[model samples]
Target: MFRHTKATDLLNSGVPIHVGMRYMGHKSANMFMHYAQTLSKTHEAEFLRYRKITTDGREYQQDPHEMYEAIALSKRTDRVLPHGYCTLPPRQTCDKGNACLTCTKFVTDESFEPVLRQQMEATDGLIAERQEAHEARFGEPMSQENIWLKGRFQEKNALSKILHTISAVRTSDGTFTPLRGAGSPQGRQEEN
Candidate 1:
Protein backbone atom coordinates (compact mmCIF):
# COMPACT_ATOMS: atom_id res chain seq x y z
CA MET A 1 0.00 0.00 0.00
CA PHE A 2 2.78 2.39 0.88
CA ARG A 3 4.61 1.70 -2.35
CA HIS A 4 1.44 2.16 -4.36
CA THR A 5 0.54 5.35 -2.50
CA LYS A 6 4.05 6.77 -2.93
CA ALA A 7 4.08 5.86 -6.62
CA THR A 8 0.65 7.42 -7.12
CA ASP A 9 1.62 10.57 -5.20
CA LEU A 10 4.81 10.91 -7.16
CA LEU A 11 3.08 10.51 -10.50
CA ASN A 12 0.26 12.87 -9.49
CA SER A 13 2.86 15.45 -8.50
CA GLY A 14 4.17 15.45 -12.11
CA VAL A 15 6.88 12.84 -11.99
CA PRO A 16 6.92 10.75 -15.17
CA ILE A 17 5.94 7.11 -14.76
CA HIS A 18 9.29 5.92 -16.10
CA VAL A 19 11.07 8.09 -13.60
CA GLY A 20 8.81 6.79 -10.86
CA MET A 21 9.47 3.22 -11.90
CA ARG A 22 13.21 3.88 -11.69
CA TYR A 23 12.88 5.57 -8.33
CA MET A 24 10.80 2.68 -7.01
CA GLY A 25 13.34 0.15 -8.28
CA HIS A 26 10.80 -1.53 -10.51
CA LYS A 27 12.43 -3.35 -13.44
CA SER A 28 9.13 -4.04 -15.23
CA ALA A 29 6.80 -1.28 -16.30
CA ASN A 30 3.87 -3.64 -15.93
CA MET A 31 4.72 -4.24 -12.29
CA PHE A 32 4.94 -0.52 -11.58
CA MET A 33 1.76 0.25 -13.50
CA HIS A 34 -0.25 -1.74 -10.97
CA TYR A 35 0.48 0.98 -8.43
CA ALA A 36 -0.97 3.70 -10.62
CA GLN A 37 -4.55 3.37 -9.52
CA THR A 38 -5.79 6.87 -8.76
CA LEU A 39 -6.88 7.70 -5.24
CA SER A 40 -10.45 8.99 -5.26
CA LYS A 41 -9.86 11.37 -2.34
CA THR A 42 -6.97 12.99 -4.17
CA HIS A 43 -8.97 13.04 -7.39
CA GLU A 44 -11.96 14.64 -5.68
CA ALA A 45 -9.82 17.34 -4.11
CA GLU A 46 -8.34 18.18 -7.47
CA PHE A 47 -11.75 18.17 -9.10
CA LEU A 48 -13.14 20.49 -6.43
CA ARG A 49 -10.27 22.89 -6.83
CA TYR A 50 -10.75 23.37 -10.56
CA ARG A 51 -14.45 22.76 -11.01
CA LYS A 52 -16.07 25.25 -8.67
CA ILE A 53 -19.42 26.30 -10.07
CA THR A 54 -19.79 29.86 -11.21
CA THR A 55 -22.74 32.22 -11.07
CA ASP A 56 -22.90 35.30 -13.28
CA GLY A 57 -19.19 34.97 -13.94
CA ARG A 58 -18.38 34.76 -10.23
CA GLU A 59 -17.18 31.50 -8.74
CA TYR A 60 -18.97 30.26 -5.66
CA GLN A 61 -16.48 29.85 -2.89
CA GLN A 62 -17.20 26.96 -0.54
CA ASP A 63 -15.88 27.46 2.94
CA PRO A 64 -13.87 24.53 4.30
CA HIS A 65 -16.18 24.34 7.29
CA GLU A 66 -19.21 24.16 5.04
CA MET A 67 -17.78 21.22 3.19
CA TYR A 68 -16.93 19.46 6.42
CA GLU A 69 -20.38 20.17 7.78
CA ALA A 70 -22.03 18.66 4.71
CA ILE A 71 -20.01 15.48 4.96
CA ALA A 72 -20.42 15.23 8.72
CA LEU A 73 -24.16 15.66 8.49
CA SER A 74 -24.43 12.95 5.90
CA LYS A 75 -22.27 10.64 7.99
CA ARG A 76 -24.77 10.88 10.84
CA THR A 77 -27.45 9.11 8.84
CA ASP A 78 -27.79 5.35 8.42
CA ARG A 79 -29.23 6.23 5.03
CA VAL A 80 -25.72 6.97 3.89
CA LEU A 81 -24.17 3.71 2.63
CA PRO A 82 -20.53 2.68 2.47
CA HIS A 83 -20.66 3.09 -1.30
CA GLY A 84 -23.75 5.27 -0.99
CA TYR A 85 -26.26 4.79 1.88
CA CYS A 86 -27.92 2.07 3.91
CA THR A 87 -31.36 1.86 5.46
CA LEU A 88 -30.06 -0.55 8.10
CA PRO A 89 -29.15 0.28 11.67
CA PRO A 90 -26.20 2.65 11.82
CA ARG A 91 -24.08 0.30 13.95
CA GLN A 92 -25.20 -2.92 12.29
CA THR A 93 -23.05 -4.64 9.70
CA CYS A 94 -24.58 -4.88 6.26
CA ASP A 95 -26.34 -8.24 5.88
CA LYS A 96 -25.51 -8.09 2.19
CA GLY A 97 -21.85 -7.74 3.12
CA ASN A 98 -21.26 -4.28 1.71
CA ALA A 99 -22.76 -4.94 -1.69
CA CYS A 100 -24.04 -1.40 -1.50
CA LEU A 101 -25.15 -0.18 -4.90
CA THR A 102 -27.69 -2.93 -5.46
CA CYS A 103 -28.61 -3.43 -1.79
CA THR A 104 -31.91 -2.13 -0.48
CA LYS A 105 -30.02 -0.32 2.26
CA PHE A 106 -28.03 1.73 -0.24
CA VAL A 107 -28.99 5.30 -1.01
CA THR A 108 -27.44 8.02 -3.13
CA ASP A 109 -27.99 11.67 -3.97
CA GLU A 110 -26.74 14.12 -6.56
CA SER A 111 -23.90 15.24 -4.31
CA PHE A 112 -22.26 11.87 -4.78
CA GLU A 113 -22.82 11.71 -8.52
CA PRO A 114 -19.41 13.04 -9.47
CA VAL A 115 -17.58 10.47 -7.37
CA LEU A 116 -19.76 7.69 -8.71
CA ARG A 117 -19.17 8.77 -12.27
CA GLN A 118 -15.44 8.89 -11.70
CA GLN A 119 -15.50 5.44 -10.20
CA MET A 120 -17.55 4.13 -13.08
CA GLU A 121 -15.16 5.48 -15.67
CA ALA A 122 -12.21 4.06 -13.79
CA THR A 123 -13.86 0.69 -13.47
CA ASP A 124 -14.72 0.64 -17.14
CA GLY A 125 -11.13 1.28 -18.11
CA LEU A 126 -9.87 -1.32 -15.66
CA ILE A 127 -12.31 -3.92 -16.93
CA ALA A 128 -11.30 -3.28 -20.51
CA GLU A 129 -7.62 -3.66 -19.70
CA ARG A 130 -8.15 -6.79 -17.65
CA GLN A 131 -10.33 -8.33 -20.30
CA GLU A 132 -7.71 -7.67 -22.91
CA ALA A 133 -5.00 -9.23 -20.78
CA HIS A 134 -7.14 -12.23 -19.98
CA GLU A 135 -7.88 -12.79 -23.64
CA ALA A 136 -4.23 -12.52 -24.55
CA ARG A 137 -3.17 -15.04 -21.93
CA PHE A 138 -6.01 -17.53 -22.06
CA GLY A 139 -7.24 -17.01 -25.63
CA GLU A 140 -10.87 -16.69 -24.40
CA PRO A 141 -13.06 -17.57 -21.42
CA MET A 142 -13.44 -15.51 -18.24
CA SER A 143 -10.66 -15.27 -15.71
CA GLN A 144 -10.93 -14.39 -12.03
CA GLU A 145 -9.95 -10.84 -12.91
CA ASN A 146 -12.73 -10.69 -15.49
CA ILE A 147 -15.27 -11.96 -12.98
CA TRP A 148 -14.22 -9.37 -10.41
CA LEU A 149 -14.37 -6.65 -13.01
CA LYS A 150 -17.84 -7.77 -14.10
CA GLY A 151 -19.09 -7.48 -10.53
CA ARG A 152 -17.60 -3.99 -10.28
CA PHE A 153 -19.16 -3.05 -13.59
CA GLN A 154 -22.54 -4.18 -12.38
CA GLU A 155 -22.21 -2.22 -9.14
CA LYS A 156 -21.22 0.93 -11.01
CA ASN A 157 -24.09 0.43 -13.42
CA ALA A 158 -26.52 0.25 -10.52
CA LEU A 159 -25.03 3.39 -9.01
CA SER A 160 -25.33 5.15 -12.35
CA LYS A 161 -29.00 4.25 -12.50
CA ILE A 162 -29.46 5.80 -9.08
CA LEU A 163 -27.60 8.91 -10.16
CA HIS A 164 -29.79 9.24 -13.25
CA THR A 165 -32.95 9.19 -11.19
CA ILE A 166 -31.76 12.00 -8.93
CA SER A 167 -33.15 15.43 -9.75
CA ALA A 168 -30.75 18.33 -9.55
CA VAL A 169 -31.45 21.94 -10.41
CA ARG A 170 -28.61 24.37 -10.96
CA THR A 171 -29.50 27.64 -9.31
CA SER A 172 -28.59 31.05 -10.69
CA ASP A 173 -26.28 31.32 -7.69
CA GLY A 174 -24.29 28.38 -9.12
CA THR A 175 -25.06 25.79 -6.45
CA PHE A 176 -26.91 22.61 -7.28
CA THR A 177 -30.24 22.18 -5.58
CA PRO A 178 -30.30 19.12 -3.35
CA LEU A 179 -32.16 16.12 -4.73
CA ARG A 180 -35.21 14.57 -3.06
CA GLY A 181 -36.41 10.97 -2.98
CA ALA A 182 -35.61 7.57 -1.54
CA GLY A 183 -31.83 7.89 -1.70
CA SER A 184 -31.57 11.50 -0.72
CA PRO A 185 -31.67 12.03 3.03
CA GLN A 186 -29.06 14.71 2.57
CA GLY A 187 -31.75 16.86 1.08
CA ARG A 188 -33.82 16.75 4.29
CA GLN A 189 -31.22 18.58 6.39
CA GLU A 190 -29.76 22.07 6.12
CA GLU A 191 -26.04 22.41 5.75
CA ASN A 192 -24.61 24.14 8.80
Candidate 2:
Protein backbone atom coordinates (compact mmCIF):
# COMPACT_ATOMS: atom_id res chain seq x y z
CA MET A 1 0.00 0.00 0.00
CA PHE A 2 3.01 2.27 0.12
CA ARG A 3 2.58 5.03 -2.41
CA HIS A 4 5.56 6.49 -4.31
CA THR A 5 5.21 9.77 -2.45
CA LYS A 6 5.36 7.97 0.90
CA ALA A 7 8.47 6.07 -0.17
CA THR A 8 10.04 9.36 -1.24
CA ASP A 9 9.12 11.00 2.06
CA LEU A 10 10.74 8.15 3.98
CA LEU A 11 13.91 8.48 1.95
CA ASN A 12 14.63 12.11 2.83
CA SER A 13 14.23 11.95 6.59
CA GLY A 14 17.71 10.71 7.48
CA VAL A 15 17.06 7.19 6.24
CA PRO A 16 20.26 5.59 5.02
CA ILE A 17 20.77 6.75 1.45
CA HIS A 18 21.64 3.24 0.34
CA VAL A 19 18.36 1.88 1.67
CA GLY A 20 16.43 4.58 -0.11
CA MET A 21 18.37 3.85 -3.25
CA ARG A 22 17.44 0.19 -2.87
CA TYR A 23 13.78 1.03 -2.35
CA MET A 24 13.70 3.26 -5.40
CA GLY A 25 15.86 1.03 -7.63
CA HIS A 26 18.03 4.01 -8.37
CA LYS A 27 21.38 3.04 -9.81
CA SER A 28 23.15 5.91 -8.12
CA ALA A 29 22.78 7.99 -4.97
CA ASN A 30 22.69 11.12 -7.16
CA MET A 31 19.38 10.06 -8.66
CA PHE A 32 17.77 9.77 -5.22
CA MET A 33 19.53 12.85 -3.92
CA HIS A 34 17.87 15.06 -6.52
CA TYR A 35 14.54 14.42 -4.83
CA ALA A 36 15.89 14.69 -1.28
CA GLN A 37 15.08 18.37 -1.04
CA THR A 38 11.45 17.61 -1.76
CA LEU A 39 10.97 15.60 1.44
CA SER A 40 9.06 16.95 4.43
CA LYS A 41 10.58 17.28 7.88
CA THR A 42 7.14 16.66 9.42
CA HIS A 43 7.27 13.03 8.26
CA GLU A 44 10.36 12.16 10.25
CA ALA A 45 8.42 9.98 12.69
CA GLU A 46 6.97 7.89 9.88
CA PHE A 47 10.46 7.43 8.49
CA LEU A 48 11.59 6.15 11.87
CA ARG A 49 9.32 3.12 11.45
CA TYR A 50 10.88 2.47 8.05
CA ARG A 51 14.32 2.64 9.61
CA LYS A 52 13.37 0.06 12.24
CA ILE A 53 12.41 -2.46 9.56
CA THR A 54 15.75 -2.08 7.82
CA THR A 55 17.80 -1.99 11.02
CA ASP A 56 18.64 -5.65 10.47
CA GLY A 57 20.02 -6.67 7.09
CA ARG A 58 18.28 -10.04 7.33
CA GLU A 59 15.10 -9.15 5.46
CA TYR A 60 15.18 -8.16 1.83
CA GLN A 61 12.61 -5.66 0.74
CA GLN A 62 11.26 -7.18 -2.42
CA ASP A 63 12.08 -5.55 -5.74
CA PRO A 64 9.29 -3.99 -7.81
CA HIS A 65 9.05 -6.96 -10.16
CA GLU A 66 9.01 -9.32 -7.21
CA MET A 67 6.04 -7.46 -5.76
CA TYR A 68 4.28 -7.69 -9.09
CA GLU A 69 5.11 -11.39 -9.28
CA ALA A 70 3.68 -11.97 -5.80
CA ILE A 71 0.43 -10.27 -6.78
CA ALA A 72 0.35 -12.18 -10.05
CA LEU A 73 0.93 -15.47 -8.27
CA SER A 74 -2.07 -14.93 -6.03
CA LYS A 75 -4.31 -14.17 -8.98
CA ARG A 76 -3.23 -17.01 -11.25
CA THR A 77 -5.95 -18.76 -13.23
CA ASP A 78 -6.06 -21.94 -15.32
CA ARG A 79 -5.46 -20.00 -18.52
CA VAL A 80 -2.73 -17.82 -17.08
CA LEU A 81 0.84 -19.04 -17.48
CA PRO A 82 2.80 -19.86 -14.35
CA HIS A 83 3.31 -16.66 -12.31
CA GLY A 84 0.38 -15.20 -14.23
CA TYR A 85 2.78 -13.39 -16.54
CA CYS A 86 1.37 -14.24 -19.89
CA THR A 87 3.34 -13.68 -23.04
CA LEU A 88 2.03 -11.31 -25.65
CA PRO A 89 0.08 -12.87 -28.50
CA PRO A 90 1.65 -12.75 -31.95
CA ARG A 91 2.04 -9.23 -33.26
CA GLN A 92 -0.41 -7.92 -35.77
CA THR A 93 0.67 -7.76 -39.42
CA CYS A 94 1.52 -4.12 -38.75
CA ASP A 95 5.28 -3.53 -38.78
CA LYS A 96 5.24 -1.36 -35.70
CA GLY A 97 5.93 -4.42 -33.56
CA ASN A 98 2.78 -3.80 -31.58
CA ALA A 99 2.22 -7.07 -29.80
CA CYS A 100 -0.50 -5.57 -27.68
CA LEU A 101 -2.61 -4.55 -30.66
CA THR A 102 -3.04 -8.15 -31.80
CA CYS A 103 -2.92 -9.76 -28.37
CA THR A 104 -6.28 -10.92 -27.05
CA LYS A 105 -4.83 -12.18 -23.78
CA PHE A 106 -3.92 -8.74 -22.46
CA VAL A 107 -7.42 -7.41 -22.98
CA THR A 108 -8.92 -9.71 -20.37
CA ASP A 109 -7.37 -8.20 -17.26
CA GLU A 110 -5.61 -4.90 -17.89
CA SER A 111 -7.94 -1.97 -18.26
CA PHE A 112 -5.05 0.37 -19.02
CA GLU A 113 -3.73 -1.71 -21.87
CA PRO A 114 -5.06 0.55 -24.58
CA VAL A 115 -3.62 3.59 -22.87
CA LEU A 116 -0.29 1.79 -22.84
CA ARG A 117 -0.50 1.06 -26.54
CA GLN A 118 -1.32 4.64 -27.46
CA GLN A 119 1.41 6.07 -25.28
CA MET A 120 3.93 3.64 -26.69
CA GLU A 121 3.12 4.77 -30.21
CA ALA A 122 3.63 8.39 -29.22
CA THR A 123 6.85 7.66 -27.37
CA ASP A 124 8.34 5.54 -30.12
CA GLY A 125 7.90 8.40 -32.55
CA LEU A 126 9.42 10.89 -30.14
CA ILE A 127 12.47 8.72 -29.56
CA ALA A 128 13.08 8.34 -33.28
CA GLU A 129 12.88 12.12 -33.68
CA ARG A 130 15.35 12.66 -30.84
CA GLN A 131 17.78 10.19 -32.35
CA GLU A 132 17.56 11.95 -35.68
CA ALA A 133 18.10 15.33 -34.05
CA HIS A 134 21.09 14.05 -32.14
CA GLU A 135 22.57 12.54 -35.24
CA ALA A 136 22.04 15.73 -37.20
CA ARG A 137 23.78 17.64 -34.48
CA PHE A 138 26.59 15.09 -34.29
CA GLY A 139 30.38 15.64 -34.61
CA GLU A 140 30.15 18.71 -32.42
CA PRO A 141 29.92 18.76 -28.65
CA MET A 142 26.51 20.28 -28.01
CA SER A 143 26.75 23.64 -26.32
CA GLN A 144 24.73 23.86 -23.12
CA GLU A 145 22.36 26.33 -24.72
CA ASN A 146 21.75 24.09 -27.74
CA ILE A 147 21.29 21.05 -25.52
CA TRP A 148 18.89 22.92 -23.26
CA LEU A 149 16.87 24.18 -26.21
CA LYS A 150 16.48 20.71 -27.64
CA GLY A 151 15.65 19.23 -24.25
CA ARG A 152 13.14 21.97 -23.48
CA PHE A 153 11.33 21.49 -26.75
CA GLN A 154 11.23 17.74 -26.25
CA GLU A 155 10.03 18.09 -22.68
CA LYS A 156 7.21 20.45 -23.60
CA ASN A 157 6.16 18.20 -26.46
CA ALA A 158 6.14 15.13 -24.21
CA LEU A 159 4.14 16.86 -21.49
CA SER A 160 1.49 18.02 -23.95
CA LYS A 161 1.12 14.55 -25.45
CA ILE A 162 0.98 12.92 -22.02
CA LEU A 163 -1.83 15.26 -20.98
CA HIS A 164 -3.67 14.27 -24.13
CA THR A 165 -3.12 10.64 -23.27
CA ILE A 166 -4.49 11.11 -19.77
CA SER A 167 -7.57 12.76 -21.22
CA ALA A 168 -8.04 9.92 -23.67
CA VAL A 169 -7.78 7.24 -21.00
CA ARG A 170 -9.74 8.78 -18.14
CA THR A 171 -12.32 6.05 -17.80
CA SER A 172 -15.82 5.91 -16.34
CA ASP A 173 -14.19 4.64 -13.15
CA GLY A 174 -12.21 7.92 -13.04
CA THR A 175 -8.92 6.08 -12.82
CA PHE A 176 -6.27 7.13 -15.34
CA THR A 177 -2.68 5.96 -15.27
CA PRO A 178 0.20 6.97 -17.51
CA LEU A 179 2.04 4.31 -19.49
CA ARG A 180 5.47 5.05 -18.13
CA GLY A 181 7.48 7.52 -16.14
CA ALA A 182 9.29 10.30 -18.05
CA GLY A 183 10.71 8.00 -20.75
CA SER A 184 9.99 6.07 -23.92
CA PRO A 185 8.27 2.65 -23.98
CA GLN A 186 11.52 0.91 -24.94
CA GLY A 187 13.13 2.07 -21.71
CA ARG A 188 10.17 1.47 -19.41
CA GLN A 189 8.43 -1.77 -20.38
CA GLU A 190 10.01 -3.35 -17.32
CA GLU A 191 7.95 -1.07 -15.07
CA ASN A 192 4.76 -2.85 -16.07
Candidate 3:
Protein backbone atom coordinates (compact mmCIF):
# COMPACT_ATOMS: atom_id res chain seq x y z
CA MET A 1 0.00 0.00 0.00
CA PHE A 2 1.05 3.61 -0.48
CA ARG A 3 2.86 5.03 2.54
CA HIS A 4 1.83 8.67 3.15
CA THR A 5 1.62 9.59 -0.53
CA LYS A 6 -0.20 12.86 -1.31
CA ALA A 7 -2.76 12.43 -4.11
CA THR A 8 -2.24 15.96 -5.42
CA ASP A 9 1.51 15.52 -5.78
CA LEU A 10 0.78 12.84 -8.35
CA LEU A 11 -2.22 14.64 -9.88
CA ASN A 12 -0.31 17.91 -10.37
CA SER A 13 2.32 16.03 -12.36
CA GLY A 14 -0.46 15.59 -14.98
CA VAL A 15 0.05 11.81 -14.95
CA PRO A 16 -3.49 10.28 -14.63
CA ILE A 17 -4.90 8.33 -11.70
CA HIS A 18 -3.70 4.94 -12.92
CA VAL A 19 -0.15 6.28 -13.19
CA GLY A 20 -0.42 7.63 -9.64
CA MET A 21 -1.37 4.15 -8.43
CA ARG A 22 1.63 2.68 -10.26
CA TYR A 23 3.93 5.16 -8.53
CA MET A 24 2.72 3.83 -5.19
CA GLY A 25 3.27 0.22 -6.33
CA HIS A 26 -0.35 -0.62 -5.70
CA LYS A 27 -1.90 -3.46 -7.66
CA SER A 28 -5.50 -2.28 -7.14
CA ALA A 29 -7.42 0.93 -6.58
CA ASN A 30 -8.77 -0.57 -3.36
CA MET A 31 -5.23 -0.64 -1.92
CA PHE A 32 -4.62 2.97 -2.81
CA MET A 33 -7.91 4.09 -1.22
CA HIS A 34 -6.41 2.96 2.11
CA TYR A 35 -4.42 6.16 2.10
CA ALA A 36 -7.18 8.28 0.54
CA GLN A 37 -9.50 7.34 3.40
CA THR A 38 -6.90 7.99 6.07
CA LEU A 39 -5.97 11.36 4.62
CA SER A 40 -9.66 12.39 4.74
CA LYS A 41 -9.47 12.18 8.53
CA THR A 42 -8.82 15.34 10.56
CA HIS A 43 -6.28 13.51 12.67
CA GLU A 44 -3.76 11.07 11.33
CA ALA A 45 -5.58 7.77 11.30
CA GLU A 46 -3.36 4.93 12.46
CA PHE A 47 -2.31 2.93 9.46
CA LEU A 48 -1.44 -0.19 11.40
CA ARG A 49 1.83 -1.96 10.75
CA TYR A 50 0.47 -5.30 9.59
CA ARG A 51 -2.94 -5.85 8.06
CA LYS A 52 -3.86 -9.48 7.47
CA ILE A 53 -6.61 -11.36 5.64
CA THR A 54 -8.61 -14.21 7.08
CA THR A 55 -9.04 -17.47 5.18
CA ASP A 56 -12.53 -16.37 4.12
CA GLY A 57 -11.04 -13.28 2.45
CA ARG A 58 -11.94 -10.62 5.03
CA GLU A 59 -9.21 -8.07 5.62
CA TYR A 60 -8.19 -7.37 9.20
CA GLN A 61 -6.31 -4.28 10.25
CA GLN A 62 -4.21 -5.24 13.26
CA ASP A 63 -4.42 -1.90 14.99
CA PRO A 64 -3.76 -2.00 18.73
CA HIS A 65 -6.96 -0.13 19.62
CA GLU A 66 -9.04 -1.90 16.98
CA MET A 67 -8.82 -5.29 18.66
CA TYR A 68 -11.53 -4.09 21.04
CA GLU A 69 -13.84 -3.20 18.15
CA ALA A 70 -15.84 -5.60 15.99
CA ILE A 71 -13.85 -7.80 13.59
CA ALA A 72 -15.95 -6.44 10.71
CA LEU A 73 -14.87 -2.88 11.58
CA SER A 74 -11.25 -3.55 10.72
CA LYS A 75 -11.98 -3.42 6.99
CA ARG A 76 -10.32 -1.03 4.61
CA THR A 77 -11.53 2.23 6.20
CA ASP A 78 -13.79 3.32 3.34
CA ARG A 79 -15.50 -0.04 2.93
CA VAL A 80 -17.09 -0.26 6.38
CA LEU A 81 -20.91 -0.45 6.15
CA PRO A 82 -23.60 -0.22 8.83
CA HIS A 83 -24.40 -3.90 9.39
CA GLY A 84 -21.33 -5.35 7.66
CA TYR A 85 -18.58 -4.40 5.21
CA CYS A 86 -18.95 -3.92 1.49
CA THR A 87 -16.49 -5.72 -0.80
CA LEU A 88 -17.14 -3.29 -3.62
CA PRO A 89 -14.00 -1.24 -4.10
CA PRO A 90 -13.68 2.30 -2.80
CA ARG A 91 -15.01 5.29 -4.82
CA GLN A 92 -17.28 2.91 -6.66
CA THR A 93 -20.98 3.61 -6.26
CA CYS A 94 -23.32 0.85 -5.16
CA ASP A 95 -26.35 0.54 -7.42
CA LYS A 96 -28.10 -1.91 -5.08
CA GLY A 97 -29.69 0.79 -2.93
CA ASN A 98 -30.17 -0.12 0.77
CA ALA A 99 -30.35 -3.88 0.35
CA CYS A 100 -26.93 -4.89 1.63
CA LEU A 101 -28.32 -7.80 3.58
CA THR A 102 -29.37 -9.27 0.23
CA CYS A 103 -26.49 -7.99 -1.88
CA THR A 104 -23.73 -10.26 -3.13
CA LYS A 105 -20.94 -7.87 -2.23
CA PHE A 106 -21.83 -7.57 1.45
CA VAL A 107 -20.46 -9.77 4.21
CA THR A 108 -20.77 -9.89 7.97
CA ASP A 109 -19.36 -12.02 10.75
CA GLU A 110 -20.41 -12.75 14.34
CA SER A 111 -19.56 -9.22 15.38
CA PHE A 112 -22.84 -7.96 13.91
CA GLU A 113 -25.11 -10.48 15.62
CA PRO A 114 -26.22 -8.09 18.34
CA VAL A 115 -26.97 -5.29 15.93
CA LEU A 116 -28.87 -7.64 13.65
CA ARG A 117 -30.95 -8.90 16.56
CA GLN A 118 -31.86 -5.40 17.60
CA GLN A 119 -32.91 -4.55 14.09
CA MET A 120 -35.09 -7.62 13.93
CA GLU A 121 -36.77 -6.56 17.14
CA ALA A 122 -37.32 -3.05 15.82
CA THR A 123 -38.78 -4.37 12.61
CA ASP A 124 -41.19 -6.59 14.51
CA GLY A 125 -42.31 -3.68 16.64
CA LEU A 126 -42.88 -1.52 13.59
CA ILE A 127 -44.92 -4.23 11.95
CA ALA A 128 -47.12 -4.29 15.02
CA GLU A 129 -47.37 -0.53 15.07
CA ARG A 130 -48.39 -0.33 11.44
CA GLN A 131 -50.95 -3.09 11.80
CA GLU A 132 -52.53 -1.42 14.80
CA ALA A 133 -52.76 1.94 13.05
CA HIS A 134 -54.25 0.34 9.99
CA GLU A 135 -56.84 -1.53 12.04
CA ALA A 136 -57.82 1.53 14.04
CA ARG A 137 -58.34 3.62 10.92
CA PHE A 138 -59.56 1.09 8.40
CA GLY A 139 -61.37 -1.35 10.74
CA GLU A 140 -59.19 -4.21 9.60
CA PRO A 141 -55.65 -5.50 9.87
CA MET A 142 -53.30 -4.23 7.22
CA SER A 143 -53.76 -6.56 4.27
CA GLN A 144 -50.85 -8.59 2.90
CA GLU A 145 -51.25 -6.40 -0.16
CA ASN A 146 -49.77 -3.45 1.67
CA ILE A 147 -46.33 -3.04 0.17
CA TRP A 148 -44.88 -1.45 3.31
CA LEU A 149 -46.07 -4.33 5.50
CA LYS A 150 -44.82 -6.87 3.01
CA GLY A 151 -41.38 -5.26 3.12
CA ARG A 152 -41.31 -5.37 6.92
CA PHE A 153 -42.11 -9.10 6.89
CA GLN A 154 -39.36 -9.70 4.37
CA GLU A 155 -36.88 -7.75 6.47
CA LYS A 156 -37.90 -9.62 9.61
CA ASN A 157 -37.53 -12.96 7.88
CA ALA A 158 -34.09 -12.11 6.58
CA LEU A 159 -32.98 -10.93 10.01
CA SER A 160 -34.24 -14.11 11.67
CA LYS A 161 -32.43 -16.32 9.18
CA ILE A 162 -29.16 -14.49 9.80
CA LEU A 163 -29.55 -14.78 13.57
CA HIS A 164 -30.31 -18.48 13.27
CA THR A 165 -27.24 -19.05 11.15
CA ILE A 166 -25.10 -17.20 13.63
CA SER A 167 -26.40 -19.22 16.57
CA ALA A 168 -26.04 -22.58 14.86
CA VAL A 169 -22.54 -21.99 13.50
CA ARG A 170 -20.91 -20.03 16.29
CA THR A 171 -17.88 -21.66 17.93
CA SER A 172 -17.84 -22.02 21.71
CA ASP A 173 -16.15 -18.64 22.20
CA GLY A 174 -18.57 -17.00 19.71
CA THR A 175 -16.60 -16.64 16.48
CA PHE A 176 -18.67 -17.73 13.47
CA THR A 177 -18.14 -18.97 9.96
CA PRO A 178 -18.31 -15.85 7.88
CA LEU A 179 -21.77 -15.60 6.35
CA ARG A 180 -20.88 -16.50 2.79
CA GLY A 181 -20.89 -13.35 0.68
CA ALA A 182 -24.50 -12.21 0.97
CA GLY A 183 -27.02 -12.54 -1.83
CA SER A 184 -30.64 -13.46 -2.31
CA PRO A 185 -31.84 -15.64 0.57
CA GLN A 186 -32.22 -18.50 -1.89
CA GLY A 187 -28.59 -18.25 -2.96
CA ARG A 188 -27.38 -17.98 0.62
CA GLN A 189 -29.44 -21.01 1.63
CA GLU A 190 -28.08 -23.07 -1.21
CA GLU A 191 -24.46 -22.35 -0.18
CA ASN A 192 -24.93 -23.34 3.47
Which candidate's TM-score is highest? 3
54-99 per-residue lDDT for model 1 (tens digits)? 2112223444234333444334554444344344544566666656
lDDT at 8, model 2? 62
Q: What is the TM-score of each candidate against the true structure?
A: 0.43, 0.19, 0.48
With candidate 3 superimposed using the best TM-score fit, by how many Å does residue 129's alpha carbon deviate from the native? 0.6
Least well predicted 10-residue stretch by lDDT in candidate 2 = 48-57
Q: Number of clashes in every candidate structure?
A: 4, 0, 0
Q: What is the C-alpha lDDT of each candidate?
A: 0.55, 0.42, 0.56
For all the candidates, what are their Cα RMSDs to the real structure?
A: 14.7, 18.5, 15.6
In terms of lDDT, which candidate is strongest?
A: 3
Off by over 4 Å in 2: 1-72, 75-98, 108-118, 121-192
Output the lDDT of residue 30, model 3. 71
For model 2, residues 1-192, the per-residue Cα lDDT tens digits are 354565567564556678888877778989876655443332322212221111111222334243334334334332233211233222323232333222222211123336444555666677667666776889554454666446544544533443443456455776443232233343377778
User: What's model 1's overall lDDT?
Assistant: 0.55
TM-score-based ranking: 3, 1, 2
